[model samples]
Target: MTKDEVRAKWAVAKRMVEITEDEYASHNVEAQAIKFVKTKLQIAIYYLSQLDEHGSSYTMPFTGKQMKEALKTPITKQNVKDAADWCHQCRLIRDKACATWNYEEAKTA
Candidate 1:
């Protein structure tokens, strides 16, 4: 996902969590949950930014024909499918396209 895409998702998540300045100031359990979610979002942002810096043309993390062939043990197709699903959910790869986060917009936001 691009940086803007990530930010858009973050905004959605933030709203879903209903983070408010007053709640943040209180720093209670709800605040902690928000912090945890924010941290995860930040990590995703960082990973996406790094991916962009490395270039979008790079190969996917795993699941190339060579990678599949290299496995000695019998690998279930589901394993690869699961990994791909997780990657997509994490925004590591979107629509099989390698994209990095746009840090400039993220920073400004």
Candidate 2:
């Protein structure tokens, strides 16, 4: 997705966080989790915003040999499916967390 698309999605997530925070008591476990997530999202948003303002250029930590070896690895259909499954699982977990926290916006997320 484009940066604009990502930003739009982030806006929705931010709003959901705000709503969740307002609904739950601060001492509640779900509220605490949301608070933690909000902090993490804020950090990520800040980092990405900085990257947008500046250039996204950065040096890779991997050595040339390590990079070459990684590149040489053939990505199979199963590998791709596994990667997608992992991402889906992560989203499912997030959705479940949101649902457990009683965040209505979780449905749309």
Candidate 3:
């Protein structure tokens, strides 16, 4: 995805809070905090993922519970893995569009 798309996703993800007064407010705060860190995380990973032509082994910081809370996905190990994997894919695509093709044009070959 483009940087703007990633940013928009992050914003939308942030606003998708399912918290209520009757529900666990502490859980809500913790989940939101995790989301904040994850957002910061995507920006960093996106910058670095571009450094590689393919991708990198970027581990997500959030635990299974946190990942489930933020993504609203199943609490499987692969689900958490896919979250990071998807970010890496976006990063590689974003970087290659700018870095790889332009460098090839400038190459001696």
TM-score of each: 0.34, 0.36, 0.35
Computed on alpha carbons, the lDDT of every model, listed in order, comes to 0.44, 0.40, 0.46
Per residue, candidate 2 scores C-alpha lDDT tens digits across 50-89 of: 3332334333222334322322225334433433343344
Note the clash tally of each candidate.
1, 0, 0
Kindly report the root-mean-square deviation of model 2 from the true structure over all alpha carbons: 17.8
Scored by lDDT, model 1 comes in at 0.44
- Model 2 gets an lDDT of 0.40
| Residue-by-residue lDDT tens digits, candidate 1, 1-109 | 5656555644543343343577478666545544444444444434544455434544435333433242223434544444344345546453234324355733443
What's the residue-level lDDT of 26 in candidate 2?
A: 56
Index of the highest-TM-score prediction: 2
Candidates 1 and 2: which is better by TM-score? Answer: 2
- Show model 2 residue runs off by greater than 4 Å: 1-13, 19-25, 57-109
- Select the stronger candidate by lDDT from 2 and 3: 3
lDDT of 3 at 55: 33
